[model samples]
Target: MSPMETGLIGIGALFVLMVLRTPVAFAMLITGYFGMLVLEGSRAAGAVMLTESYSTVSNYNLIVVPMFILLGNIASAAGFSRGLYDAAFAWVGRFRGGLASSSVLGCAIFSAVSGSSVATAITIGKVALPEMKRLGYQDALSTGSIAAGGTLGFLIPPSTGFVLYAILTEQSIGRLFMAGILPGLLLMAAFIGTIALIATINPEAGPRGARVPLGQKFRVLVQSAPLIGIISISIGGIYAGVFTPVEASAIGAGLVLLLAFAMRQLSWNGFCRAILETVRTSAMLYMVVIGANVLNPFLAVTHIPETLGNAMVGLGLGPYGTLAIIILAYVVLGMFLDGLSMLVVTIPIIYPVILQMGFDPIWFGVVAVIVIEMGMITPPVGLNVFVVKGVAQDVPMTTVFKGVMPFLLAMIVSLLLIIIFPQIATLLPDLMFS
Candidate 1:
C-alpha cells in the first residue's frame, strides 16, 4: 500500500479515537505509534519515536511553558484578577454595558499574564460574573464577554498556543510573540467596540450607571498598579529586549508572590495550591507536546503535508480562498481539540503550507490563533464558554453562546485586518528584532 493511503487510515483512526472520547494525547500517541509500525516496520518506528520524544521533552526553550503557567497560577492566588476587574470596572462601570465591558478589559490585561484560555476564563469569570448579574447586565452579554475575552490569552504575549505555533513552524519565538501583539490589541478593541455598539442599539442592553467619584476611581487604579507594573515588565520587556520570554515569566511569578504578600492575600496553603495546580497543568501540556512530537513525524514521513501544500499551491486558488478554507477547518477541529493541541496537530501541516504561500510565519501565527480563538468560543465544545458557564451558573450555556456572537464577529474582523495588513502583525517584530 502507498504511504498516502496508509496515512489516510492513520488520520481516520485518530479521528475515530478522538470521537470515542480517548484523551487527545493518547489518541495521537497510539495512532502515530501504530501508523509508524504500518508504514516503517515496528522496530524502526519504535526507536525513532521514543528517541524523538525524549529530546522533544528536554528542550531548554520549552522550559518557559511551566514557568509561564506557574506565573498565571500565582497571579490568581495573589488576588490580582480582582484587582484587574476592579480597575476596569471603576472607570467603565458607569457606561452602558459596564460589567461586560469591564470583563473584556479585565481579560485583555489577564491575557498578558496567562497563556491558557481556560485559566483566563475561569479567573476573570469568577471575579466578573456576580458583578455583572448584580448590575442587571444580560446573562448572554456577561457570559459571552467572559468567554470571548478569555481567548485573548491565545494571541497575547506569552501565549502557549503561539509558543506551540513557533515550535511547529520553526520560527523565532520573539518574532512570533511580537507579531501577535498588535493583532491581539486589535481584537480587544474590536470586542469592546462590539459591546458598545450592542449597548447603543438597545439601551436596556447596557444602561449607564452613576459614575464613581473621581477620587474613588483614582484609588482603585492605585490598587491595580502592581498588576500594571507586572504586565509592563512581562510584555514591555519582551518587546524591548530587556528580557527573554523565560526571564520575564520568572520576574512576573516573583512579583505575583511579592504582591500577594504586600496585599496580605498570600497564605502558605494558598501558595502550595497554586504551585501544585501549576505543576499539574504544566505536566499535562508537556505530555501533549511529547505526544505531538511522536505524531508529527509520522505525518511528515507519510509526505501528506508536502503533498497537500504542493497541490493547494498548484491549484491557483487565491490566498484568501485557501485561507478561508483553513479557517473553517480550524473552527471545526477547534471544537474538539484544545488550542495547544490544535496548534501541535495542525501547524505541522498547515503552517508549512502558509509559509509556502509566501506569508510570514509570525503574521500567520497571529491569524491562526484568532481562528482557533473563535473555536474556543464556538458552541457544543467551546472550552472557554463552558469554563465561564461552569463558574457563572446564573447564565445558561445558550445565553453565553449568544452573548459571544458579537465578539466572535469582532474577532473575525480583527483577523481580517491583520490578514490584509501583515505589517500590523509584523512591524513590531521587525522594529525590535531587526
Candidate 2:
C-alpha cells in the first residue's frame, strides 16, 4: 500500500480512538507509533518514539509551561484570584450588567497568570457566579459570561495555546505573545459590550450593581496589587525585552510563592497541593506535545501536509477565500476537540497552507487562538462551559451554552476585524521587535 494511504488510515484510527473515549494524547501516540512501524521497520519506529520523547521532555521552551502553571496554582491557593475578582467587582459592579462585566475582567486578569481555560473559569466562576446569583442576575448571563470570559486564558499573553502553537510552527513565543495582546483586549471589550447589550435589552437580566465609594474602590485595588504586580513584572518583562519567556515564568512563580508565604495565606498542605496539581497538569501537556512530535514524522513520511497544500493552491480561491475555508474547518473541529488537542493535531497540516497563502504566521496565530477560544464556549465539547457548570452546580448546561451565544457572536465580530486589518494582531510585535 502507498504511504499516503497508510497516513489516511492512521488518521481514521486516531479519530476512532478519540471516539472510543481513549485519552487524546494516548490516541495520537498509538496511531503514530503503529503507522510508523508498519511503514518502516520496528527499529525505525522505536527510534522515532524514543528520540521525540526525549527531545520534547528536555526542551527548554517547554519549561515555561510548568512555571506559569505553578504561578497560577499558587496564586489560586493563596486567594489572590479572589482579590482580583473583588477589585474588578468594586470598580465595575455598579453599572448595568456590571457584575458580569467584572467577571470578564477578572477572567482576563487571572488568565494572564493561569494560562489554562479550566483554571481561569473555575477560579473566577467560584467568586463571580455566586455574587451574580445573589444579586438576581439571570443564570444565562452570569454563567455565560464566565464560560466565555474563561476563553481569554487561551488568547492573552502567557497563553498555553500560543506556547504550543509557537513550538509547532517554529515561531517566536514572545512575538506570538505580543501578537495576542491587542486581539485579546479587543475580544474582552467585545464581551463587555455584549453583556451591556443584554442588560439593555432585558433590564432584569442584569440589574445595576450597588455603586462603591471611590475610596473603597481604591482600597480593593490595593488589596489586589500583589498578583497584579507579579503579572506586570513577568509578562511586562517579556514585552520589554528584559527577559525570555522561560525566565519571566520562573520569576513570576518565585514571586507568587514568596507572596503566598509572606501573607501566611498558603499553608504547608496548600503548598504541597499546588505542587502536585502543577505536576499533573504539566505532565499531561508534555504527553500531548510528545504525541504531536511523534505523529508529525509519520505525517511527513506520508506527504499528507504537502499533498493538502498542493490541493488548496489548485483551488484558485484567493487568499481570503482560502482563509475562510480554513477557519470554517477549525470551527467544525473545535466542536469535537479540546483546544490543545485541536492545535497539536491540525497545525502541522493547516500551517503550510496558511504560509502558502501569504498570511503572516504571527497574525494567523492570534486568529487561530481566537477560533480555539470560540470552541471553548461552543456546544457539545465546550470545555469552559463544563468548567463553569461544575462551579455553578445548580445551573443547567443548556443555560450556560445559551448565555455564551452573544459572546460567541462577539468573537466572530472580533475575528472579522482582525482578518480585515491584520495589524491589530501584528502591531505590537512589529513595534517592539522592529
Q: Judging by TM-score against the true structure, name the best candidate.
A: 2
Residue ranges of candidate 1 with Cα displaced over 4 Å:
none
- Residue 252 of model 2 has an lDDT of 99
In angstroms, give how far residue 279 of model 1 lies from its true place. Answer: 0.8
Task: Write down the lDDT of every candidate, Cα atoms only.
Answer: 0.84, 0.94
TM-score of each: 0.97, 0.99
Error of 1 at 328 (Å): 2.1
Error of 2 at 194 (Å): 0.5
Q: Candidate 2: which stretches are off by over 4 Å?
A: none
